[model samples]
Every structure is written in C-alpha cells, then in structure tokens.
Target: MVRGRDVILEALENLNEDEFKRFKHRLGTQPLRKGFSSIPRGTLHSLDRLDLTDKIVCYYLEDYGMELTAEVLRAIGMLEEAVRLQQAAGQV
Candidate 1:
C-alpha cells in the first residue's frame, strides 16, 4: 500500500507553483510554526488545507512529534479525509 508520505508527496508534485505558495501561506498561524520545520513545505500545505488549527497541530506534534515522517502524515490525513467523505456520503 502507498504510504501517507507518498500520497502527500504525490499531491505536492501535482500542484503548480502558485498553488503551492497558496498552500504554504494558509499555514501561517504562529502556533503551528514549531512543526513547520519538521515537515516538508508540501505537507505543510496539506495540513493547512485540512485547517488543523495551530493549537491542534501543536497538541498532536507534542504527543507524536516529528516522527510522523512525510508518508505517515500524508497517510493519516488521507485516511481522515476518506472517513469524512464516507460520513458525508452517508448523510446524503
């Protein structure tokens, strides 16, 4: 199975330069700054899109830390999105 990091990386590869910049800017909350160093820029954008508040990111990063790696973070995020999608579909 493809790892989460791979999924995130794949997503990054697909974005145009402007899109990528927008992604980065979305993550500008000060609280998330600590994690900004651990993850790659592309993954940062993904987190931003997910709208993980600075507090949430800090909480998760504090507990799990940067060890999540690129693949794992992507995988987890994708899984969360999938679950949300499934739930939304069920509501229809």
Candidate 2:
C-alpha cells in the first residue's frame, strides 16, 4: 500500500518553488485548532520540501498529515493539489 508520506511528497513535488515556499509559510504561520500547534519557524527553517513533508507526516501521523496538508494546500489556493492528495489517499 502507498504510504501517506509518499502521497504528501508527491503533492509537494508538484509545486513550483514559489508555491512550495507559500505552503511552508502557511505551515509555520497558520493558526491551528486547539491542541494542535503550527510548525515552528526554526523547524521549518532548516528543512527543504522533502524533509518538511516527512516531518509533517511523522509529527502528525498519516491521517492528520493528510488533512493538514490538504488544508494548507487549499489555504494557499492549491485546490487541485489538495484534491489530488485526498484522492490519492482514498479520502475523496
């Protein structure tokens, strides 16, 4: 079976540099719901896109990683990537 990290990596890989930067910005800055924290700027600072995706998956686990990733994608106007992620994960 395809891992959630694989799905997330694919989505991130599809983004151009600017979009990927925006996505990381959102992850570092967005206000998450209660009990959930945004990724720290320091944490985000050191990682490239692939590492960031891995961090998200490991930190949030598969399910929440999928949701949070899609949410961030949509927040940055990447609806197609969000949908594709959900579909790939069989959540659509």
> Highest TM-score: which candidate?
2
What is the C-alpha lDDT profile of model 1 across 1-92, one tens digit per residue?
43333333344444456654643543333234344544444546666433433423454442232222222333434444334333333333
Residue-level lDDT of model 2, residues 19-87, one tens digit each, is: 998988888877666667767788887788789888997778777888889999999999999999999
Instruction: For model 1, name the residue pairs that clash.
Output: 4-71, 4-75, 5-70, 5-71
Worst 10 residues of 1 by lDDT: 62-71
Off by over 4 Å in 1: 30-92
Per-model TM-score, in order, reads 0.35, 0.89
Q: How does model 1 fare in lDDT?
A: 0.39
What lDDT score is found at residue 87 in candidate 2?
95
Residue 59 miss distance in model 1 (angstroms): 10
lDDT on C-alpha atoms for all candidate structures = 0.39, 0.86
Alpha carbon deviation, residue 58, candidate 1 (Å): 12
Clashes, model 1? 4
